[model samples]
Target: MTNSLPTESELQEAWIELQEIHETYLLPYEVKIPHVDQYYETARSIWLAVLFYYKEEQVHKDVISDVCQRDKPGLARDQQVRHLKREGWHLSGKGGYHSLDPFQPSPEWVTERNRRSGRLGAADFTQLKKFYGNACATCGAKEGRPDPRYGQDIVALQHGHMDPAKPANDKDNIIPQCQFCNRAYRSDYVFDDKGRVYAVADVGPVRRASRQVQKKIYEWLMSVFG
Candidate 1:
């Protein structure tokens, strides 16, 4: 089978920020490569799965299983994935779906999928800014306001995709987002016109689940991350 995941070289190229993540956030090695040689392949496979989904939330065990055939296919997917998370990948996984942090720089395919440029024209972006009153559509922060987190820096409105799986340059599916919120949600959620979180990309495992089960999952995540 032709592997669908991006090549390791491509991942390394797109995620240059990963070098910093390794030294600061990740565990054990203070380096990307785990010291234990056997677990290394499993770790590598999980990353490929993450990059495959890119910004899209996914039910990824199957993908992981496929890619890790050469790594550690027999190992439980969650354990391997959690190892990376605990070891320092800023990932979110629960309710059987996983999503990568949106703050990471993404591959070109996001804005230019299927050879269709989603948001190329500066005129379109200019119009979007005007429509949203020159403010971040998601956070309502006016462009050039001082960023609360970045001292002496101003907030800049960016083109954030509503559905990352689709071509992002399309005016219809795009929203004006502050750099903060754009990376905060990624494509993990869907929002409404009022810029409230509307729904998650929970189409798979969450389907047919009881309301109690859903609520428990929600509460569990809150407690874990809280």
Candidate 2:
């Protein structure tokens, strides 16, 4: 039999279930992300668990480990971050600070047309850039300001709509963004040139303690296990 990919509905259902499980069981601790026990294992298992959770399929740890090894090799801690950045995986920080960038998987920056496609004109985008000072809201590095070697690559961030476009912008709808976030996720009308769309409420970061590196680890862990 040929293997079949999951339908979008299946994926959404799985993601919802994963969040439900996390909320009911693990959200209380406010310490560690549930399901991950050891540091190395935690680092390794997080991504596969999220893949399975999002794909709504049973997953094997060996396969997960193999993928991590294949993609990241000896560098274990950052594999999940790379995965999210490359694949637009739907995930979140299990603890504080997702990464030094605070925006992982980068695709989360694209805002979906949700019913508000009516309001997402060039003006909205311009206002957004102005509000964030034309720099990455998460990183604060403006265009032309990133390392010279990185050039545009350094400041090529995008805009993330605070609320899904369906509800439309009501003043609190704008936010600065970067390439490290997931784009409009699971939403129709997300254009190829525009980038993928993600839910703003689901991905936004708040004030917290952990330093940059520690937060990066925690954020990478969320990309994996969540």
Which one wins on lDDT? 1
- State every prediction's TM-score relative to the real structure: 0.36, 0.23
State the TM-score for model 1: 0.36
Instruction: Report the lDDT tens digits of candidate 1 across residue range 1-226.
Output: 3277545555444345444444454323232333332222445534534443465566455555554553455755444553444433445667645656534322332333312432333357876676677787778888889877767678898987777666876766777888888878767777664467777754544555799988998799899998
Estimate, for each residue in 1-226, the C-alpha lDDT of model 2 and write its tens digit. 1123333344445445554554564343221233533222444244534364435433433444444454346754334443443333334443321321212223332332212342333466765565456765544556555535455466565554444543445434445555543242312222222233332233233223357856886799799999
Best by TM-score: 1
**Clashing residue pairs for model 1:** 118-169, 118-170, 119-169
lDDT of each: 0.57, 0.42
